[model samples]
Target: GAIVWVHASQPVQLGSGEALEQRYDRRPGGPRIHSFQVDGGPNRLIEALDKLPGVIAVPRLGTVEEDLAALVRRLTSGDPAPAVVRVRQGAGGAERSSEDRTAPHLARLWALQQTQELRAKRQVRDAVELAGRFQLVTPVSGAVVLENQQQYDAAGLTPVDPQTVPSIPEPGTWALLLLGGAMLWFGRRRRPR
Candidate 1:
């Protein structure tokens, strides 16, 4: 028996009632899509879906705006489209209520890094980070928040890798003095004729 490794999304499931669900496993950079049939208990599907990048349950299709719907469709479809999409928090010029506040700066920075840097570099870690950040900002639920936090921890994305020097040692530029000293000592070198 050989161990096979694969980068795949949770299986797509056609569940009973409103539970019927599909997973869109986005390729890092290319326009590739994979879907699998989700089996087992609802808990399994729920858990799997929770880990997907930008996996919003879309509780109400009727309420979702047209642009957002299209965006979702494009993201989930198997077309020659960008695998990762930079989703603005209030995209489609949708208005946000006072209750729905924006995420913290660190969260926003993480999102930017995930989508712009890591995603551009085609790193799977980016997706994991993106998903975790999305879950945090979105009103997902206590259970999902806990589950995503676990995922982030597993991926080494949690705690945000502390800095060796938490605060700036000095305000002035160390480089300026060092370089100036070097220039004064060495002076100008004569070019060979």
Candidate 2:
């Protein structure tokens, strides 16, 4: 599969104190639109369209000012933002504005928050997978040979020894542990005093 590298430059602080940036991909196809977001200090919530695959390499673009500007224009020009536009209205009265109407700005904010939460969950899952992989021994000889031994002897290399080991317990083990702990607590509570 062809890999796309989407890169975001260091965010530029806007006049309104919001940091903005353009994320672009450098694949065989033209640059793809990633996302933009308001900076709520260091841990700003970023809203993007989709997640990248493991093998994809997204190279960051140097200048994000143009992209940021474009997004801002699109957002403030009365055209609703994609993710939270539905929150603004429902069924029959989609066009009717009400006092309780959720502004597009607020909807965008909520969407950004949701996006950040999704990103965090993905990071946690990735970390857990990496931790599990770390416990297993990987063959490094092949990688070293392919990287550094372009002209060196490749036929006399000894095969890597395979160590037989069981895979880690499924995450269901954690759920069972929690369930047991809850049951123990309830049993204790039901006892005298």
Candidate 3:
């Protein structure tokens, strides 16, 4: 929903005049990373989106408006792809140079596993991994929230095979209307008698 900036690791200058995202460091005096600003969530909402496949956005019907929720795909970045290493036969195909940029995935986990506290090891690793996964980085996933359709004169969005937004009754108003109708019916009956 907002532009978020994260610092890129391992110093490497981006190609001059590169397009895609406009890098920014909203934090004062923070290291600037490549502006890979994707449509991501902020905080808890994003957290929920990241963990689950999707989140349902129920419509707010306080105003009795006909609102529509459409399925739309948002553009966002996911985890970086791993480098594929291939072997070359000797002379004709020798084992080519290997560049292992990433640390073994399980090293930290193993370290936590080896701690003095045996029972705490798994818990520690799990907690650490989860934190590391969500920390700082923006999480992207399928999220269904009340569609902002009112903007642009509320006519810009057209949901495919739309479902009608049900009209929900205002509690006090409905009760009062029913009471008034009942009183009128009773009064009419008395006059006839």
Give the TM-score of each candidate.
0.22, 0.18, 0.18
Prediction 2 TM-score vs. true: 0.18
Give the clash count for each candidate.
2, 7, 5
**In model 1, what lDDT does residue 148 have?**
60
* Superposition TM-score, candidate 1 onto the true structure: 0.22
* lDDT leader: 1
How many residue pairs in model 1 have overlapping backbones?
A: 2
lDDT of 1 by residue, 82-172 (tens): 4445444555677545465554554555564455444335464655557464443321222222246678787665444334213444546
lDDT against the true structure, each candidate: 0.42, 0.39, 0.34
Model 2 lDDT per residue over 92-189, tens place: 86654545555444554544444434434444444433333333211111132333343435654443323423345779998999999999999999
Cα error of candidate 3 at position 26, Å: 18
Please tell me which predicted candidate would have the highest TM-score against the true structure: 1
With candidate 3 superimposed using the best TM-score fit, by how many Å does residue 134's alpha carbon deviate from the native?
23
Q: What is the C-alpha RMSD of each candidate to the true structure, in Å?
A: 23.5, 23.4, 24.7
